[model samples]
Structures are given as C-alpha cells and as structure tokens.
Target: MHTLAQLRAGELSGITRLDLAEGLTEFPAQIFDLADTLEVLNLSGNALSSLPDDLHRLTRLRVLFCSDNDFTELPACLGQCQALTMIGFKANRISEVPGAALPPLLRWLILTDNRIENLPTELGERPYLQKLMLAGNRLQSLPPSLSHCHRLELIRIAANRLSELPQWLLTLPSLTWLAYAGNPLETEADAAALEGTAHIDWSALRLEQRLGEGASGVISRATWQRNGQPDTPVAVKLYKGEMTSDGSPLHEMNACITAGLHPNLIRVEGRIGDHPEGQQGLVMQLIDPSYRNLAALPSLASCSRDVYADDCRFSAEVALRIARGIASVAEHLHQQGITHGDLYGHNILLNDQGDCLLGDFGAASFHATTDNLETQALQRIEVRAFGILLGELLERIDSGLSDERRKVLEDLQRRCCQPQVLARPGFSEVVRELRSL
Candidate 1:
C-alpha cells in the first residue's frame, strides 16, 4: 500500500505493483512515473470517480483493481493497455460498461455489486476471457454474442433482474462454474420451502476458536446452550452481510437451509438470530477433525481448476467412492430445485476412509422444478462442473491400477465433459455408471 508522499517523492518509481487507498477523489498524476515498470495497480477503497485519459501510459500493466470506489462507468482508456488482462471494479456505482473500455487480452473481469443493466456484445470477442463475476446487478438479459466465449469458465450472475435464463449460456463449451440465484426467474415454491428454519438467539451461544473465513463470512467453533437441553458443540458462520462476488449472504443461507440434511452434506442445526451487531449467521454440525479439503483453490496459471497437493494420490477405489458420494449429493440437490454451482474439489472434504462431504452454499441457486427444460439445462451445466472435478480426481489415481479399470474411469470422464450440452449425462446417470464400476 503505497502512500501519496512516496509516490510524489518518486520512491516507488521502479516498483511493478502499486496500491493506493488515501481516499483521493481524483487520480494522482505522480503514478505515471512508474508506468514503465508497473504491472499491477490497485486503487480500491477510495472516493475516486474517474481515471486519467492517458492510463494507457502504463503499457506493462496486466492487472487493475478499483473496487469499493465511486466510479459510475468503466474508463475507456483501459482498452488501450495492450498487456492488461485482469480488471476489477467491484462494489462501485457503475451502471455502464462501454464497449471500447475493455482490453482484447482480458481474462478475468469482476463487476460485482454494481448497477449495470446490460453487457456489451464485444465481451464475447475476447478469446482469452475465462472468469467473469457480475452478481448483484440490475441486468435484465445477456447478450447473445456471449455464446462465442469458448474459453469462459466461471461466471456469477446471481441477484440480477433477468426474466429468464439464456439458452446460449447453457451451451457454452468451456463453462464449468455458474450461479444465478436471487433473480425474478426463481421459483416461488423454492422460496417458500426455504423458510421456517429453527432460529437460535446469539446470546445463547458461547464462541470459541475461529474455524475459518471465506469471501462472504467467518466461521467459528461454538457451543450452543438451551434452557433445558445440554450444551451442544457446533460451527457457526456469521456472514459479513455485504454483496460478495458470488451473491448475497441471505441467498446463501436460504440455499443452505433448503438443502436440508443428507449423509453426504454438512448438517445445519439452525440459523442464528439477534446478533449483537445484527449480522446473519448459521449454526451447523462441526465437521470431524479427520476431514480435510481435497484440493487447494485454483492458482493463477490453472485459472479455473483446483490444484491438488503434490504428495496426494487417490487409489482407484477411493476415487470411485468420492465420485459416487458427490454424484449422489448433486442428484439430491437438483431434485430439490437447487444447484451447487461451485462444486469444485476445493469445496469438498474427505477422510482417509474415502468418505466425502460436500459443503458451502455460497454459490448455490434455486430453479423451478416445473420448468423441465430450464431445470434440465441448469442441471446439465452443473454436470459439466462435476465432470471437471471427477476428471481431476481421476488424474490423481494411483498409476498401478489395472489398465482396464483406468480405461473405464477415463471413458466416464469423457462422457461427463462432452461439449454437446444436452448430450452429457445427468448426475443420476453419472451415479448409475459409477456404481457399475
């Protein structure tokens, strides 16, 4: 985090990255001095409403972040930076995305928590585009040209005003992770069904050590006390209550409650009420200590896929066990009008015995079960995501396995990842095939 004084004094002239957050209402001209060497720039958490027209001076910049600012539009000068590939303007008041504001080499673009109502057709023209975050916006429809995004993978369009899901979005070849909850198109049945969860007052819980934290909230180990009942150990997630890149915390909590309980899913005890600070929270069954994340989050190089630890290896039997467990839970979720949009290995936990549990409702969405076509397409899209995970698991299988057995698993992965959208099998079919193996 560089200060204006250092920049003005030319002390940061040779740096490759610069971060400034002094609440300036205008661009600092001194930043141009590092244009020759700067590769990443962050000006987030400020009151800035515009950028310099000559932002192209940073010819070597590859990543730019201006989240939590006051910008009402994406700067057009960003298009001239030939090396810029990643741009983020999250939590801004942006209502417009000019066609000429985007660079051709863009790969990751985040405009979450904005007021944008439409996207440019040129967004699909970027051949290298992969990750796109557009949740919490006012979009009514998506451009048909987005179908041309062959390299696209992760996309979050939740909390928008879209009247219907785009058919072209369902057929995107490289799409793996997708979320569209909190839209008008969501079903009433699911909304009503998601309510009536048990509520626990915040004062009754005794907080313990911190468990973990994610983009939406922080989890902690706690002990719940009842008037006549014995104390119970549980895991509590207190949401930060802000619009995240994925969607709102309220929607995630609803999805988690609607999902109910299954052997393969983490159990939700109840929702937390009367938080001292008015924050939303949930009380869930604490996972056993033996369980650990199956893989790490994706790296810059891998872009959209999970990266497993190098020393990890799964036996053929263990891989099948993990596949069957996830397939079973996914089928259950779809049957309840829910889609676990972010079903990656990084979200799954497993024990040495190969028993797996799928958790995290941050990217889950609800769809109308009566709308068969749309529901089927939505499920198939998630099937592709699961297939990608399955393929990754298979890649870590022990090499000494029989060639015939390995061939069977490889063939199943190919079928799951088929580019012809509807041609791919559903989770139920996937489970059936895995059981036969």
Candidate 2:
C-alpha cells in the first residue's frame, strides 16, 4: 500500500505493484507518475471517486482492478493505453460509456452495477472483447452493431430495462452464453398485448445450431428429455437479447406449441430452462428438410440466358404439387384458429418425403373467435406470401405448363395476391381447388 507521501517523494520509483484497497478515497497524481513501470493496480474496496486522466500514460500497465469503487465516470484518456487489457469497474455510478474510452486490446470488461442506459455501437466493433458483463444497468436496449464482435463469447446483461431485443444478436455464430432476466418486457401482461395466448411449459432442453434469428430472439436446434428418457432432438427458440417482459418469448413459444403439430407445421416439444441463455428454450421437433428460400435462392437474372431458359421449363404437375402442399398447411393453421403472419417460401421447409413444413413463428398469432378481422387480415398476408412462393417455384422447375394448368395457377395466385383481404379465398378453398388439378 503506497501512500501519497511516498508517491510524491519518488519513494515508489521501482514499485511494480500497488494495493490501495479501502484506504484511499482519491487517486493521487503522484502515484500515476511512479506507475510507469507498474503492471498491476488494485484499488478495489475503496471510495475513489475518479481516476487520473493521465493514468493511461503508464504504457506498461496491464491489469486494473477498480471494482467496488464510487466512480461515476471513467477518464476518456484510458483508451490511449495500448497495452491495457483487463478492467474491473463493477459497482459504480457510471451512466455513459464512450467507445473511445476503452482500448482496442481490452479483453475483459466487468461493469455489472452501473447506470449505463446505452452502449456506443463502436464497442461492438472491438476485435478483442471476449467477456462483457453489464448485468445491473438501466439499459433499455442493445445496438444491432454488436454482431460485429466475432470473437465475443459470453455476454451477461441481466436486470436491465429493455422492451424488444435486436434480431442480429441471435445470428452471431460465436456467441455461446447469454443471460437476460428481470426485465419488464419479460412479464406476462406485456406479452399478452402481442397476442391473446396461453402459457406453455418450456424447461429442460439443450440448444445447438440456430434455425433463425430475429429482432426478438433466436431459434436453434435443441434436444429435450421425454418421459424420464434421455434427450430427444428438437428445435429450440430463445429470446436473443434483453426484453421488457418475459412473456413475449413465452407467448410466442406457447402459441407455436398449442397450435398443435402437423406434417406441414413445425412441432413444439417443450422448453429447456427459465432464463434465456440458460436451459430456457422452446423444444420443437426438428424438421429434417432443406430450405429453398426464394429471397436467397439465385434468380434467373443471375444465370446465362440459355441456362435460364433451360431451368424455366415449368411443369404443371410440379407446380400443382407445390401449391397444394402450401395450401394444406395454411388450411390446417386456419382451422386451429391460428394465422401465420408471414408464409413466404423462406419459412416453408421441404422434407425428404416432399412434404412442406411451415416455420418461423415470429409473427404467428392465435384467434379463438371465428373470422375475426385481425385473423382474416393475417390469413390474407399469408396467402399473398404463398402466392409469391408459387410464382417463384413455378419459375424454377424447367417445364412448360399446359394452358389449363397455367390458367388455374394464375387464378390461384391472383386470389392470394389480391390487396383486398375479403377477395382472397380461405386456405381451405385454395387447397380444394389445387386438389382438383
């Protein structure tokens, strides 16, 4: 423990270590000068209000332990320390964190008990950040730019005030552990606003590959134990980042599960744990199928004219098959008082048996009442998406369609694409007509 007098007298010239724990209330500038060769500094358990602005001048300093301090703000010049890597500022009053205040080589940043409401987007661009702990903050949301941190592995942000989560957070391939609890957005009432639905049990599951990533959370491959047996493979859906209410993710998961299982619909098995990053994830029967997302698939415009023409040979039988499969799924969902908010080709999966499975329930809703306007509108939107998918698929298979087949499919597409919701035929009607073909 070096005192201010020793620092001022240059008595600590060769001091490579310093411990000012619980004894000092302010950082002495004189100590900063003698720390030119200091590599470790532990000022924890003290009432230090601020750090010396020129503290970064200690070019050889490597570790900083300032946890349990009274720091409301950090010195901006700390970024100049090219060699600094570990920083512990837990239990402080810091509300704002500028991107430039942190060095690029920083690997561990622990800021659990701060008033930080937001993080600079540049923080996510850091290449060396590995573990970020911002659990006890007043943060309302996270920046989508966090996806830039390819090396980030663990992010603990519990007890924050966030409403909705960003989608890109779920798509990060490197993220292995995440925690978001004690938020208002995770409440039951808040989730009820999105859709009037019931809760479903989703605990005791293990997650693997991500199936889809969205603004609210991520859907991944998971496994669940059945009837005291070992794990059963399934797909797990998890809320990605901070949420205002726990009910939002729960509502979506429950809706998907209660909507009942179908050959064309992804089946929900159960949930894993209670927290987002923990075992808490929705377990659904995995669809072992290939996805032909129209949005991502190569279009005829990208290929040579000859190749494009060769692939554009549309077959009526194949067109009818695709149309019928989609209609059948839509019909089932409608009968169960459920409406798929978006039903594009990307959400449709094709199994080995040539069956179509509807997925991506990010926007799905339930309607206990019959023919409600909201449900009807959702159905209309799904029809439009199905119509778009039909057009794209027909444009893919290389075969000319008979005039009769062309007329029928064109009519079906028209009904589904109609801007007037009432003009669109119900999914049942579409399926009946396709079966006739």
Best by TM-score: 1
Mind sharing the TM-score for model 1? 0.94
Per-model TM values vs. the true structure: 0.94, 0.47
Model 2 score (lDDT): 0.63
Question: Which one wins on lDDT?
Answer: 1
Least lDDT summed over 10 consecutive residues: which range in candidate 1? 187-196
Stretches off by above 4 angstroms in model 2 are 1-212, 225-231, 241-250, 274-280, 289-316, 351-353, 372-378
The positional error of residue 226 in candidate 1, measured at the CA in angstroms, is 2.5
- Where in model 1 is the C-alpha error above 4 Å? 189-193
